[model samples]
Target: MSKFIIITGGVVSSLGKGISGASIGKLLQLNGLKVNMIKCDPYINVDPGTMSPYQHGEVFVTTDGAEADLDLGHYERFLDVNMTRANTNTAGSIYQTVIDKERRGEYLGATVQVIPHITNEIKRRFTAFENEVDVSIIEIGGTVGDIESLPFLEAARQLRLEKGPKNVICVHVTLVPYIAVAQELKTKPTQHSVNKLREVGIEPSMLICRTEKPLSLHLREKISLFCSVPTQAVIECADAKSIYHVPENFYKQKVDEQIIDLLGLTPKQKVDPKWFEFFDKAMTPSKSVKIAVAGKYSELQDAYKSISEALRHAGMNNDAKVEIVFVNTEKDNVEEKLKTADGILIPGGFGGRGVDGKIATIKYAREHKIPFLGICLGMQCTVIEAARNLCGLHDANSTEFDPTTKDPVVDLTPQQKNVVYKGGTMRLGNYTADLEEGSLARKLYGKDQIVERHRHRYEFNPAYVKQLRDTGLKVSGWHEGVLPEIVERTDHPYFIAVQFHPEFGSRPLRPHPLFDGLIKAGLKRKENK
Candidate 1:
């Protein structure tokens, strides 16, 4: 059976609960344990696919096509483990399942309630991975006092009883706010947060305090006394220069050893030298490069969280610091915004918002010979721009924006035509693309056939494939030679677009080839100038 570690947040939101959970998982992995992390969202939405990026940030699509919370991306990046549909659950999904089961008479005329019914469903999902993993760190979404989180908290509390307290541990993350007037860190909030958790029948085995500075010995002792946790179990997660530094931080604080001692797990191996090397490279880069991201959600960086992290990882691989200049096409002039960039990146997005600006930016990159990398919607915009400016089609556009356009260079895939429900239907997850024999993509990837992840509805319309190919747009890759997956141009130095979110698969140690290629091109363009 897998030992369970439940991480819950309190005092405030956005306290890096996911990062902490991921850091713990990384340490356990170093100890030669097969560890996996799962997320439990308290929201009522069945998935985050229908939520706006502004509200919930990016909807991370797993390889199994699960539209999960963005924290899943952090889990994948840190742990290097591919999550699945079963790794994430929501209140909405749990309720829907229970209600459907009841309607089918699975409960046998028993009255449905939140206690046994909802809590049972939640427990089943969390413990489903016991046979597959040695340790499963489940991060519960939202704060302790949230109404939507009560059932999950109760379920975790009950799980401690069923799994035995020796196999279950709760790590509560709470804020340690500093009072400017008093110039002292307050433990009152932390105390109240822990009190709230205990009131709900869940006592924390560890307390991770989020603060701007290190917790003083007095502060740690105070928290330990009030929260009833040992002084060493009061971990301090001070602000770090990079999220990658967190695992090292936790290791330094002996959090990993503490966790192992409590869980009664013995290490097959003690330390990981590879993680240290990766962290060293991230902290000390040789050079710096500037990349401009042209998008609608430029105002909110979280909307393109994974892309930004991928770029950073690529820069680290090349020993360069990546500085992102967010260009809000709806507000900023596209030409001016992109003129100073070493490379231009158009991240994946939906709707027609700031799309014309993105198209203009793509045209600028193409015409000026600036290195350009386009993602899902970015790829569609590039094709549309090529059809309009290069192929002499003045009104080329996607049906997603202008359904009445005469030249529909980009349209919904035939398979997605009947996907009336907007939640989970799309050409998503991992798919293999056959690369051209002698193309830039194949050269960068060093393979003829590559597998990438997708999160889009529209694809390069096959009817206009010949027309675009006739005008110097090289169709470098395809999915079984039917749907275009990667498109490039031979005339330019580095102009490529992929109808998939390659950023999703990029990692800190091994960057995605596409992003790595773009950063290298950016370096070349910078040196030439």
Candidate 2:
């Protein structure tokens, strides 16, 4: 059976609970322990698919087509593991399951209450994969005192009791603010947060203090005595230059060692102290490039979390720093805004809000031979732009933007045409695409076929494939020979777009070839100019 590590937050939200949990998870994996991480979101959305990016950041898609919370992205990237539907559990999903069971009379005619019914399902999600891995880290969403987190917190309290203290442990991440005027670090907020946790019957085994400055010995002891936690269990998490450095910081405090002793788990191998290979790369970079991420949600940096991280990984590998410049696609003169960029990227988004701007940027990149890359909706806009300019189709547009245009260069997939519901109804998860010989994608991937994650409803309409290609558009990659997966132009130095989200598959040690290729092209442009 797998040991459980339940991470909770208190005092307030956005305390880096996800980062704390993933940091410990990476430390566990380095010990040769098979580690799995799951996220328990408090939101009632069945999934994050329909939520606004501004509201919840990015909607991270899993290998099994699960549109899960963004925390799962942190888990997968830190542990270098593939997360699936079972890894994401939300209030909406649990409640929906229980109500469906009730409709079928599975409760034996008894009035189903929230406690035994809802909490039981919640615990089921925690233990469903217990025997399959050595350890499972579950991070609870929202603050401890929030109304939405009550059921989840209660379920966690019960699980700890049932699994025994040795089999399960709770780690509370709370803020310890430093008052600038007082010239001192405060611990009262943390004390109250712990008190709240204790009131809910969860005695956290450890308290991870998120503070701007390192906690002094006096402060740590004060927090431990008041919070009823061990002195050694008071971990300090200071802000770092990179998230990858988090695991290294935890390792210094021997957080993983303390955890193994608390849970009585035997390591599969000796833990390595030099587990800072990724962090080391992140700390040092000789050069830099400015890549403008022009998109619909550019105002919110979190909306493009994975895409930005993927680019950062490529930069680390290339021994360069990636300076991301956000360009609001809703604004005017997008081409002029992107002219100074070493690279121009158009990330995925829904609706036609900033599509004309994306098209204008694509046209500028193609005509000027500036390195460019597009993804999902960005890819669709790339095709639409080509049809309107090169193919001389004055009314070219995507069906998503203009359904009755004279040339529907991009349209919804046949299967998506009838998908009436909005939630989880897209071409998602892992898919294979065969690359053409001598194509730019083939050279970059160095393989005949590759698989990547996708999450989009529309695709390049196959009817216009011939017309676009006849005008210098190269359909270099395809799925099932009928659907286009990648497109490149014959006249440009580097102009490529893919229907799949390669960012989802990128890792720190092994960056996705597409992003790495873009970074390489960007570096070339910087050098030549």
Candidate 3:
């Protein structure tokens, strides 16, 4: 029988519920349980694929090509698991499923409501994971008492009844804010939050209190008394030096032990030696490498969450601390900011908001022989930069930015020309590309053919491929007929650009080769200097 643990947040959003859930999941893994994670989003969008980075942060892509919540990225990094499309679903997606079934007469003409139809669909998503793993940890987005969260909460309540109390545990995370005037942490918000949750027909078995300072015994007792949880079930969550330290932090607080006791499960093992080793190396690096990321949404680090973690993973593999310098191409002098960096990266983005600055940065990296990596929109900009500077096509550009350019080096694929719906309509998920036998890409990947996750609609123009290749630029990887997937400069030290997002596939224990290659080149440059 599969057990279920549902994590919910209260008192605020961004309270680290995702990290809490992931840390608990890690503890379960250490105990020899096959743990799986699922993220329940409250938004109406079917996925974050079409949402702006400013609106929803980074859209994390699963191995199966599902564009998921950024929390899924945290789950993958902590659990070291490859999440599939089934691991993520939004309120919009659930409603869409219910409606699709209703249209097909699965409901038999009964008018569907939020109670039996929507909530049932939500429970079905939870039940789908029952047979696949020993335990499934589901994180509910949004705080308690929100109108959007009612259905998800109700579904969780019903699931506990259906699966029996022994098989279900509700873990609620709430904030314990401190006031400077009183110089004390308040528990009113957390109590009210728990009160609100209880009103929805569910009581949290454990409460993870988020606090700025160490939790007091008095405060724990107060929270325990008010929230109706045992004194030990009120676990304190102090801020950690790094998010990776969370599992150990939770272990110190006995959160995992409490969870095991509540679930009535016996551990096969109490610790994973490999995890401790990885954490040790991650904390104590011998040296450091600086990599500058030129991105439009650089102000908010969460906007480039996966890229930041991928660089860290590569840094760990190379035994170097990764220092990421965020350069906002929309405002900063791109060349001057990146002049002292060991390597440069141009991440994906939409619009022409900072194209000129990005083009200048790419040109600088190319001419100076600095190790450079371009991803998605970044790759398109690289091609455009090469076409304009080397091929002498003065007005070369992507049609996405300038439709009236004399030379359209990048344009929309034929398949996307007539697509009217903007959301979830793109060349998404995974696609295979044929790698040139002796090319840099094949060498880095150690494979002749590669499958990568893509989330773009534009491609390098086939008409300009010959012209660009003749100018010493290499088309190292390609898709079915003339679509360029990977480009490299043979003359430069380590300049490669790919239309796919490699950062999505990178893991802490197993860093992606492209990132490892870039970090290696950067470390060499540092040593040479």
Clashing pairs in 3: none
lDDT of 2 by residue, 1-529 (tens): 7899999999988899999999999988988888888899998999889999988999999998999888888988889999999999999999999999999999999888889999999999988779899988989999988889899999998998999999899999999999999988999999999999988999999999999998999999999899889998999999989999999888889899999999999888887766597568667799898898989887788899999999999998899999999998898578778878999999999999999889898988888899999999889999988999988899999888888888888888778998999998899899999999999999999999998899998889888999989888889999989899999988887889999999999898889998999999999999999
Count of clashing residue pairs in every prediction: 0, 0, 0
Q: Sorted on TM-score, highest at the top, how do the candidates line up? A: 1, 2, 3
Output the worst ten-in-a-row residue range by lDDT, candidate 1.
Answer: 272-281
Residue 520, candidate 2: how far off, in angstroms?
0.8
lDDT of 1 by residue, 1-529 (tens): 7999999999999999999999999999999999998899999999998999999999899998889999999999999999999889999999999999999999999999998999999999998789998999999999999998999999999999998988999999999998888999999999999999999999999999999877999999999999999999999999998999989889988998999999999988978768966876678787889999999898899899999999998999888999999999778999987888999999999999899999999999999999999999999999999999999999999999999999999998777877889888887798999999989999999999998888889989989888988888878999998999999998899999999999999898889999999999999999899
Quantify all predictions' global Cα lDDT against the true fold. Answer: 0.93, 0.91, 0.91
Candidate 2 segments exceeding 4 Å error: none
- Which portions of model 3 miss their true places by more than 4 Å? none
Model 2: pairs clashing at backbone N, Cα or C within 3 Å: none
Candidates ranked by lDDT, best first? 1, 2, 3
